[model samples]
Target: MLLPPKDSVLRQASFTNFWISRILSSTSFQMLSVAIGWQMYALTHDAFSLGFVGLAQFIPMVLLTFVVGHAADRFDRRKIVCLCQLIEGGIAALLLVGNMAGWLGREQILLAAAILGACRAFEGPSSSALLPQLVPKHILQQAIAWSTSAGQTAQILGPSLGGLLYSLGASCVYGAATIALLTAGILTCFIRVERSERKTEPVSLRSVFLGLEFVYRHPAILGTISLDLFAVLLGGATALLPIFAQDILHTGPWGLGLMRTAPAVGALLMSLILAYYPLQRAVGLKLFAALAVFGLATMLFAISTNLVVSLVALLLTGASDVVSVVIRSSLVQLQTPDEMRGRVNAVNSLFIGTSNQLGEFESGVLAGFIGPVPAAFLGGLGTIAVAGLWMYLFPSLRRLRSLSES
Candidate 1:
C-alpha cells in the first residue's frame, strides 16, 4: 500500500474556501472584541462592567447550545453557518450605527454581545461539524492544524488593525469589522461539501441528550474537556488586559493592541511548526506539560510590571496553548462519529465558552475585589493545581500516545 502525499488538505476546494472564510470571520471577531473591550473599559472605568461583556455573551451561548446543536445536526450546516455570519454582520452594522450616533453606551454594547453570542451558539457547532465533510480522514489532523494556524494569523493582524482603526474612531473599527464579516459570509457560500446522512431518530429528551451521553461514557474526552474548562476558567487573563494596558503598564490603545497580539504571535509561530511537523508521540503527556507551561506563563504575566516582560509571558502562554489546542482538537475530531459531531461539538463549545467568556467574568469579579494582579496570580495557581490533579485522575488520558492511534 502506498501512502498519500502530505499537505493534501490544501488541494481540496471546499476546505480552501472554508479556510479563507475562517480567516475573515476570526479577524472580524478579534477586531470587534478589541473595540468592545476598550470602549467598555473607557466608558465605565469599572472592571465589573468589563466582566459583564463576557457574561452577556456567555449566557445566551450556554442557554441555546442544545437547540443550536440539534439544528446543526438536522439542517444544512453550510446554510446554517452562512446565515449566522450574516446575522453577526448585521450586529456589527448595528454597533457601527450606534457608535456613529454618539449614543453608544455600555448597555447597547452588552446587548450586542448577547445577540452575537446567540449567533455564535449556532455558528460554532455548524462550522465544527462541517469540517470533517470537507477533507479526507487521513488529513483531518493536518486540516485542523492549518485551520488553526489561519485563525491565529487572523488574531495576529486583527487586533493591530482594530487598534489603528479605533484610533480614528470607534465607528471606524466597527465599520471594518462589518466589512470583514459580510465578506466572510460571502466566502462561506462558496464552500461545497457532501452532507452527512442525518439521524432519523425522533426528537426527544434522549436525542437532545445524546451528545452529553456520548461524552459521559468516554473517560478520555471527559477528562480532557473538563481539564480545559477549569484550567482556562481560572487562568484566563484577557479580561484584565485593559487594566494592565492602562494602569499597570501605562500604555494607550496602541500598546494594548500590541499586548493583545503577543499571544497570537507566539501561537502562530508554534502553529506553523506544528503544521509541518505534527505531534506524533506522547500526545497526552505533552498536553499536560504544555498546560503546565501555560499556567507558569500566566503567573509570570501576572507579576510583570514591565511591558516587554509581560509581552514575553503572554507569548509563552499563547505558544503553550497552541499545543494544547492542536492535540485536543485532533483528539475530539478523531474520536467523534460523524452523526454526533454537531452535538458533541456543541457540548465542547459550551466548555470553551465557559472557559473563555465565563472566565472573563470570573477574572473581572475577582479583580473588582482583589485587584487585577492578585486575581491573575491566584488564577494561575489554580491552573497549575488543576493540571496536576487532572493528570492523576485521568490515567487513561495521561497514557494516551497518538492522535491517529487513539
Candidate 2:
C-alpha cells in the first residue's frame, strides 16, 4: 500500500495544537457574543442596541491596535498572548456575575459587551502575529488554514451551545463562556516564547502610522485585504440571524445556532479539501469570484424560507469567506517582514476589525430600517458592486500571481 509522506506525523501535531488553541479561544468569545445578542434582543427587541454591542469593543480596538501590535513586536509574544487571555477571562467572569445577579439590565449588558470587545481587539492581533512563530515558515499557509478551520468549527459548535444554554438562562451561557476563557488563559501559559526577532526602533505614533501607510501603498496587499473587508462588511448578515431564525424560519434558539454554524460547516469542509491540495493557481481571480459567490449566497439566504435552503446558503457564504481570509492573510504575511509584522498586523487588525464589527453595526441599522431580509439582500448587492469597482480600481491585484511564482 502507498503511504503518505514520512513528515506527516510531525505536521499533524503542529496542526493539532495550532487548531486546538484557535477552537478554544474562538469558542469562548463567540459563545459569549451569541448569548449577548440573544439576551439583549430578547430584553429590548431592538437591533440598534445590538449594533452598540459591537461599537463598544471596536472603538477600543481601533484605538489600541497599534499599541498592541507594537507590544507584540517588543515583548514576548507568548506572554503578551497570556496576559490578554487572562484579561479576557476576567472580563468573562464579570459578565457571568452580571448575568447571574439579575443586576444586568440592558445598559449593563451593553457595557460588558463593549469591554469584552476591547479585550478581543487586543487578543486578535496578538494571536494572528503569533502564528508564524508556531510553525515552520513553509507550513505557515497550512497553519492559517487549520486555524480558520478551527475557528469556523467553533463557530459551528459555539452558537448552538450558546443558544441551548441561553434557553436555560443567560447565567448558564455566561458562566460557561467565562470558564472557557479562563481555560484559554491556562493554555496560553503552555505556549513557550523565545525572545522576539523584531528590531526595536523608538516607538512613536508617527512610526505606527508608517505601517498603516505601507499597507495603503502596497496594492496586492491592500487590495486583497479590502476585497475581503468590503465583501464581508456588506454581505455579512450575522447580526440579523436571530430575526431569520425566530421570525422568518419559525424556529427557536436551536435554529439560530444551526444558522450560525452553517457557514463554519462549509468553511471547514472547504479548508480540509484545500489543505491537502493548495489553492495557489489563479488565486487572484478565484478571490474575486469567491466574494461574488459570497454575495450571491447571502442574497439567496435573505430570500430563503426553508431551513435547509438557508443552511445551504450560509454554508456557501462561509466557504467563500474562507477563501477571502486565506488570500488576504497570505498577501499580508508574504509582504510583511518579520521585524514589522506586529505593527503591520496591527494595521491589518484595524482594517479587519472595522469591517467585521462595523459590518455588524451596518447590518443591525439596515435591518432595523428596511427589515432583516431586505437589508441582507441589499447588503449582498452592495458587496458585489464593491468587488466590481475594486476589479477596475486595482490593476495590481488583478495581476498578482502565486507567491512561489512571484
Candidate 3:
C-alpha cells in the first residue's frame, strides 16, 4: 500500500503542534489573569487599582504593536513564537517561586504582571501572522474560528480551575500556570514555518505611516474594527463581575469563576454553530445586530442580581460578541494584501486589546465614582448608543450583503 508523503506528515505534525501550543498558552494566560484579579482585589479592594493593572498591560502592547507588526511581516514567525513562549515560561516560573516562597507581595506581583504584558506585546502579532503560514488560505477562516474556540475553551475552564486552586492556596494557581507554560514550550518545539521573501530595505517611521494610511483608506475594514472597539469599550461589564459575585450576587470566588465562564460557554457554542454553517450573507448587518444584542445583554446583566440571571445575560452577551468578532476577523483577513497583513492585523490588535483593557479601565473608573451597579448599567446604555451612531455613520456596513464584498 502507498503511504502519505513525508511533507504531509511534517505538515500534520506542525499543525498539531500549533494547536496544542494554543491550548496550553491559552490555559496559562487565563488562569494567570484570574489569579491576578483575585490577588489584586484581595490586596487593595479598590476598583481603580484593578483598573490601573489593566492600564499597565495595555500601554506596552500599544506602544510596541506597530513594531511587532513590522517584525512579524519580516521575520521567521516560528522562531519569534518560540522565543515568546520561552520568555512567558520564565515569567510563570518566577510567579510560582515568589508565591511558594511567601514573597509574592502585591507590588511585586503588579510589576511582574506588567513585565508579562510586555512579553505579550511581542507575542500577539507574530502569532496572528504565523497561522496563515501553517494552514491553506482556503481554510483560514475556519482556522481562525477554531483558534478562537480554543481560547474560549480555556476561558471557560481556567478561571474556575484557578478559583478552586486558589482556595487550596495562592501557590496552586502559579503552579498550574507553570505546568501549562511548560507544555506550551514543548509543543512550540515541533512547529515548522516556511521562510518567505523579505525586502532588504530598512524599516522606518514613514513605513509605519503607510500602514496607518492603508487602514484609513479602507472604509469597510476601518468601520468594522472601529465599531467593535467602541462597542466593547463601552459595554464590557467584566471588570465589575467580581463585585457582582461578592456583594450583589452573594457568592464568592466560585461565583466569579461562573461569571468568567458564562461568556466563554456562550461563545464556544456560537463558534461551533458558525463553524458548521459559516457567515456567508449579510455580514455587516449581522455584525451590527450582534453588537446591539451584546449591549442589551450587558444591560440586563448589569441590572440583575441573581446569579443564574446574571449568567444567562452573560451567555447572551458572549454569543452576540462572537458574531461581531467573526465578522471583523473575516474582514481583516480578506481585505488586506499578503505582505501588509501583519501591519493591518497589528492595527486590528491595537483596537481589540485597547478595547478590552480600556474597557476594564472605564468600568473600574466609573464604578469608583458612581458605584459599580449604576456604572455598569450606564456603560451598557452607552454601548447601545455608540452602535446606533456607528450604523448611521457607515451606511455601506449596514447594507453589506456578503463576505466577498470586502
Candidate 4:
C-alpha cells in the first residue's frame, strides 16, 4: 500500500478516518468501564466483586489470544476490527436494554464483560497490525504518537463523560457508547488496505503459537513486552479508584469520573509532545527512567488522601506510562516482519490484557484482603523492584540506543 505524501499524517483520508474512529471506539470503551465499575460497586458494595468484574472480562481474552492472532494474520484486519466494533455496539445496546428493563444483575454484567473482552482480543491486535499500512514508514512512529494521543484523549473524555452520564442514568451512558461504537464501525468500513499478504497457511497449534515464539527470539522485544507486563501488573491503581472515590475520597460518580480522567489529561499532553518532538537519544535509559518515575508516582498515589495529590500521582503515572508505551510499541512494529506482525501484536496484546485485566483482579483481591491503601502501596513497591530487576536481566534492552536497533 502506498502511503500518503510526506507532510501530515491526518492528511490521508484513511488514516484520518482510522484516527477518528479510534477516538470514538476508545472513548466508548473507556466510558463503559466507568459505568460498569460504578454500577457494580453500587450493586455489590464489596471490593472483591469489583475485582471479579475484571477477571470475568480477562478470562475470555486469555482463552482467545492464540486463536485471535491467527485470525488477524489470516483475515482482513480492517474487517475484523469493523466487526468487533459492531459487536461491541450490539453489546452496549444489550446493556442499555438490560439497564432500562431493570434486569442487569451481577450475572448479566459479568457476562457482558466477558463478551466485550473476547471482541477486544481480536480488535486490539488487528488494529495494531493494521496501523503501519496507513502512513509512510518515516512517520510511522509519529503516527503512533498521534495514535496514542487519540486514545488518551478518549480516556480523558470517556470516564468523565461516563460519570456525568451516570447522573442522568446508566442507560444514558450505554446509549451514548452504542452510538459512538456504531459510528466507529462505519468509519472503519472506509479504510482500504492492500490485501497482498498470502493467507494460505493452515490453522494449527504450531501456527497459532508462532507469535509467542517470535517474541521469545528477540531479546529486546521480549524485555519491553515483559517489562510492561510486570510493571503494570504491580502498579495498576485505577482498579481501586472506585473504593477510593466512594470511601476515602468521599465523592460521587462525578468525582470518580474526574479521577479517572486525570491520568489521561497527563497522557494527552505527553503524547502531543512526543508526536512533535520525539525521543532522539539514550532511548534505553529514558525508558528505564520513565519506568522508575511511574513506580514513584504509584507510591505517591498509594499514600495520598487528598484528591489533588492522588490526581497528581495518577497524572505522573500516565505521562510516564506513555513514554514506555510509545517506545515499546514502535520497537515492536519496527522489529517484526510484515507477515508475522499480526501474531506478534497479538502476543503483545496478550501481555497487555494480562497486565491490565488481571492486574485489576489482583489489585481488587489484595485490596479486599489488606485494604486499598496497603494493596496499592505494596504494588508500587513491586513495580519499582521489577524495574530494577528487568534492567539487570535484560542488559540489551537497557543498553538499546534506538528503535531501529536489533
Q: Candidate 1: RMSD over Cα atoms?
A: 3.6
TM-score of each: 0.86, 0.84, 0.86, 0.87
Residue lDDT tens for model 2, 138-209 = 656666777777777787788778878988988888788777777777777676533455778888877766
Global fold similarity of model 3 (TM-score): 0.86
Instruction: Give one digit per residue, the lDDT tens place, for model 4 in 72-121.
Output: 88888899999999999999999999999989988888888888888888
Error of 3 at 65 (Å): 1.6
Off by more than 4 A, model 4: 1-11, 34-53, 97-111, 240-257, 303-306, 361-378
RMSD of every prediction? 3.6, 3.8, 3.8, 3.5
User: In terms of lDDT, which candidate is strongest?
Assistant: 4
Worst 10 residues of 1 by lDDT: 1-10
At residue 240, what lDDT does model 3 achieve? 91
Residue-wise lDDT of candidate 1 within 265-379, one digit each (tens)? 9999888788778888898899899889999999999999999999999999899988888877777788988778888889998888778867888999999999999999999
lDDT value for candidate 4?
A: 0.88
Off by over 4 Å in 3: 1-12, 36-55, 98-108, 169-171, 198-201, 243-253, 365-374
Candidate 1 steric clashes: 0
